[model samples]
Target chain A: MAVYTQVSAEALAGLLSGYDLGDALSFKGIAEGVQNSNYLLETSRGRFILTLYEHLVDHAALPWFLALTTHFADAGLPVPRPVRDRQGEALQTLLGRPAAIIEFVSGVSVSTPTPAQAQAAGAALGRLHGSAPGFGKARENDLGQPHWPAMAARCLEGAAAIDPQLPALIEAGLRATRDWPAGLPTTEVHTDLFPDNVLMLGDTVTGLIDFYFAATDLVAYDYAVTHAAWCFSADGRDHDPALASALAAGHAGTRGLSADEIAALPQLGVGAALRFTLTRTHDWLNTPADALVTRKDPMAFARRLAWYLKATPNMVLGR
Target chain B: MAVYTQVSAEALAGLLSGYDLGDALSFKGIAEGVQNSNYLLETSRGRFILTLYEHLVDHAALPWFLALTTHFADAGLPVPRPVRDRQGEALQTLLGRPAAIIEFVSGVSVSTPTPAQAQAAGAALGRLHGSAPGFGKARENDLGQPHWPAMAARCLEGAAAIDPQLPALIEAGLRATRDWPAGLPTTEVHTDLFPDNVLMLGDTVTGLIDFYFAATDLVAYDYAVTHAAWCFSADGRDHDPALASALAAGHAGTRGLSADEIAALPQLGVGAALRFTLTRTHDWLNTPADALVTRKDPMAFARRLAWYLKATPNMVLGR
Candidate 1:
């Protein structure tokens, strides 16, 4: 979400007059994302997050975001609810940016979540997978958009400066899997269920944030992403095993990971890690500093690629 | 660079009133960049590119880009001279965007560069290294941004989804070189010298563009980036053995490649690839779609890592 250029609040409020969120008390962008503009807002009775749809988000598919969150909420999941306009529409135009408001959750993002916490997250993620099937949104996930491998190759070019072996590693990964997983359950998964996205109150997981990358993907893929997030250290190196059993237990409490999912966890985890690194590399290569967005280093994630492999061995060992 | 929600050309033109780049015949953004809003413009004088100063671009270092290009042109290098205004101001304000105009080189970036091409590019890059030391500017490169590693770790998390082993490999690389090679020549280098930034006519390299990331860095690091870019295949694996030599030839045509540089090439190449893949991954995790920017994959570059390690044993084998 490019923010180098500022977006005005008054202009956004004017366009949102068509919504059911009641008269806007105020709306101003809260700095957080690189793919979309997030606004903290106050309404007649509550505080909410107003988002300006950027590129990765499809305005036409917005009903899915609103509906999925609502569906999960109705299913007794702790998730935000989309505030609709008086006109009965959840999606609307604001400051010419595609807009929507969701109730905000206040809690610390579990940056260094405990193993049990990870297990719980894993469990919750499993539940999310279970609930996603019920979501009206049943679209295929855009794993690597427009051109995936080509973009990776491009990034490989940039990172090669740091490590001469980088290009071959990239190519090996590309050759390892050129096509998508043949068959898997597709559901609305919170694709980016990193520790930072999950809010925590002391030891209990509170709520999740940053669902801008959520989409219908393989449930195991979500698990893979979670595993990488939960198990890695700040330096992107492997740590003690994540709360895998607890996560599985929690997930089993709601749903269950099949034999296939267990087998595919390692590959999926690598895929998630690769995806984020490539994307970040893109930002590093292009984003203007004035964009007010911080560019993340792709190497941190690259280092974790080793962690994923180690986890895979552990995964099989546990099995 | 962030293209604002509302871009006003008139506002930009007002700032450039003092500078003359001929009448702005037309301005159409060429949406393929990481740091600036680049437009292909047609003026009475000829074709030119108008670039808005973007994120991380230190406007204070404009002298490097301007003076270097001017120096090269004066030294018989086919280079683009920045167009200055009546007041000899090369930069002007446009619609709140800081911009400059440069002569456009006529050529397309090569999709496939041969070993010979790689050598030429290498040599030119070496010459760039030679020239970097003499650039009268006194500025330091800001590659030590806090967000770089975080972004890389984020991508590694994603990479795990594709191949679990990847995380482990990356971790090893990071730990192995916590403290980079010492006693290396460091200077201002074209940090963003990706293939797209290099223009080639037939087999001859024409010019280099986009110097926003150009700053003081490890000399070997620059060569690593150049090799990673010039030596790989679409699959992200396989490089030419003679490639480094070709670059050496290009540089040696005027300057020369040191034995230290040649010995360090394989290792530096690996580093360069890692940097890009990780950054690309980070962007993938965060990129918004409206930017039409695509996320890159690190697996492709991950393969390059091992390849470089293997190539190292043989780098001096036949040579």
Candidate 2:
């Protein structure tokens, strides 16, 4: 979350005019993320999340968000469809920012999901990928930057700040991630589908949120991203491979993965982790005290890199 | 070099009572680094690097400095051994701090070396590992902490401050490295052997300096470290398989390598790179501008990681 400055209720209320409601009840600033300002909007009609673009959510892509949700809902993939104003505009000017009203998703976040959950995530991803091409025009996810080296740099920077032993680990990362051949598969990917992103009703996944970074990339890439997330704990490392097994199972449920995909999983997992690690780690050192954003340590994702090195078996690795 | 405070010549002379270089000789002050407080020292004795033991190097490990270098020198490898005073102490009390004087090794750092050079580093490492056990006593390189969770937490703390993309990465590293199965092959290893640490003269390998983080670990670990350094240029994402072949050849010339060693080289190369990248990257974010110690950019090592991933063959990356 990268909250900067403040949003007033009056500005928040002004953006609420388009939604179908009995009357405007109350509005409050809810979230200040890296890319957007979110408001918890209430009305006699229902509760909704009004988000103003702040970080990387493109207003140009605002139509994509509105249309994609409508498509997903039509496809029976339960998602909160964005609501347009009376003028049929999906976007509106709110406090000099583009804003949209999205149906509030329901479900508690699953922090420590079971193997079944991992598989579910994988299956959901497969389903999403399988269905995505039908929903929107081809586009790039544009993860913004290369994950590994940037991440490694962030970790090394953190190690220098306080942890001495960590510097060697960073050195180790630089050594291991150095030039070698690894190819990638591109498709539509939800690059950030960790446990926090997925909302669960008991053991089953009910909803997924935070689609600000969703775009076309590798299906294997999503597997790697989910694997890194589901397979690990609070730290960037893992003591269990069950999450991996579950993710594989889920992915397998959707479409049988090839040897190349299996082999590439770990590397992709590393890449995904590195992406988050670098960005979050950067925040840790630079975010202001008043900001709600939290900084992440680069070393956390770096530590898990070794896991990818050993997790995928040789037979499964593409020859 | 993490210099909290600079020590003056008078301050240092006050510490060395018997073997004084006089105030005119060793000019001491704060130097740049995230590791140790380096004071540039010169006298009739020749130019030397005076380092105050910072967070990374412990005062108790002083003997290892003298012992490891002498051991490497005895094994026909050029190592920077610390100079001892008449009191038979390599480290002396200087300004209420522990300090050591080492002969400044002069050589141009290798950016791109021949395949022979990479192999030499491997062979040299094997020889060094073989020689380390001969020391009278073993010293553990206490980087002080190895808790992956804590490391990840730090990343999380800084993530919101610097980059919002970090939380997932921080979590990934913590979870992955937490119970990784590929345990180390304990031997005396140079945990921090980078290109700058390994000096070269006219294509032939002359010396391996900086034993501050030597420990009993995998000999492959050192290969990973040096390979990452020798295999790639400052920035490139694709590693040539030829580099690995050269490394294997050079290493094979010294201590005989196992098939396992050869197979694991590529992955180890990645491991080494990732470790350093994270540490240096983190340091780059947090280190104060006023500090003399220059923070290293983990990005400097990113190209090699990309290269390693691309060029790494499935056979070499064994199950």
Candidate 3:
């Protein structure tokens, strides 16, 4: 439910003059992506999504994001293909903001995805990981372990204002995962694969969106993030073992995991939980009360971290 | 941009079970109407608008609004025909709010409508006025002249906080229109026909939407509202005489206005200005700072009223 910027019809007409997509028949701001203002645009050519990148996304990293999706789409992966203007550029400026028109993918994003949907999402993610390695660009994960200490410290500073127990809980979680195993396999990972980002038609995954968070990170950690996302209830405390097993199996079928990767799943899962917890805590504290975007509750991830603290590798691996 | 209630997938699926419109392929909340939650719903059937009525609309008035559109649509008027469910009811409950699935009308709404578009809108509005007399159900205009005094008082009470000159200006408007002309011809009127509500494909008017403000009022008053809307600049201060003349010509071409109606146009235009000014003033002052809906600038209508206070019938009618 976000449309931070309002685009006028006259401005849209001026922008469309550079594109070959014909005149816009209908243009509407849609509540889709959280990081950008998205509009469901219908032109004489077809239906397309016009996105104006918001402040949360760095302009320098946009080319990488566009290229990554273009790479996936060119490889016949289920992703939104960026539509280029007559000048052969996918990105342009509209209303003083970087904007792009991407092909509209038809599928409903499920909030409470079933086990079958979880499996399909896992398989799609594994395929993405395999395909993305061929792309030559490398982006260091900006929200990874190295940045966690600073984020955690910021969260601790505002902890007492948000909740009395937040600081101690975050400190304990940080201490537990400070010595995570190193030298794991690295690849391009969609650090955010929450159910909202994956589009599904019944049991099939039709599209994967919001690649703005894609970065070079541990492959198993991507699976860990997905597991944390899909295999938990809304409360974040209750884990669904069936969904987790199915997701893991789906990933194995596409891109099999190594024994070391399996062994490190629990620690990476804890790390994944902390990464989200810290970012969400920072957002929860920083976002203005009058902002259009609703901040996710950080406690949900904290609850997941609490569960991971007591769980063994067998719990996530279903050994 | 309003999607006050977030509809979950499970709830959407439940709602669709009662309709023949196959599973939802894509559902995106649209930033269109301010008073309701609108989603551009694409199902296996086709495109439709799924609207959940907000608290601002009275629940009892739902049927009258639906039936009125249904009547006009059946008569081949350019309106969004309501799609009835399996029970043959257009209005139903979804996400604990009065919801309806309306046929999606193609074409884009213009912010700054061209003179030709203004003419087309005038002609279409005339047709609607002619066709709506047989709608059987009659709803009194809730924001009519009788309600103006209380609204004026409310605005005056809060005027100093908004602006120093507001109270004096409003008091003058209230005193000037206190004894408005009586015995005007009344009929079903679309009171809120702003440029954004009328869809146009090139120069043709494709659809007129957001009939939630429709009621039985002076037929000339509806035209007055349209004149103020279509003839004003974005700043709501400057009036385009050519556009106003064209709009008047277009309306007269369809259903010629009576001599009395033409004579009352200026006073009605002033009333139209006051009606909107009061409502916008109320919303501007009352809407919470954290509310998702942006309060429109009341000063726009204030400026319009100031213009109307000085204009003669010859200026509006081009006699």
Per-candidate TM-scores read 0.47, 0.45, 0.98
Candidates sorted on TM-score, descending:
3, 1, 2
Instruction: Please give, for residues A245-317, the per-residue lDDT of candidate 2 as tens digits.
Output: 6677776787646777765665555456556655555666676664434456665675665555555543122
**CA error at residue A256 for candidate 3, angstroms:** 2.8
Clashes in predicted model 1: 144
Q: Write the per-residue lDDT of candidate 3 for residues A233-300, one digit (tens) a residue.
A: 88786998988888987888788578899888888888898898899889998988988888888888
Candidate 2 lDDT over B168-260, as tens digits, reads 444443443344326545567787766556665545556687787787556776766766766655554445556666766666677645666
List A-chain TM-scores for all predictions.
0.86, 0.82, 0.97
The Cα error of candidate 2 at residue B82, in Å, is 72
Fnat, model by model in order, equals 0.03, 0.00, 0.73
TM-score of chain A of 3: 0.97
lDDT, candidate 1, at A269: 61
Quote the positional error of residue A88 for candidate 1 in Å: 1.0
What tens digits encode model 1's per-residue C-alpha lDDT throughout A166-252?
Answer: 555555555544655757766788878877677655456657666667787778778767766666676675444446555656666
- Indicate which candidate wins on DockQ: 3
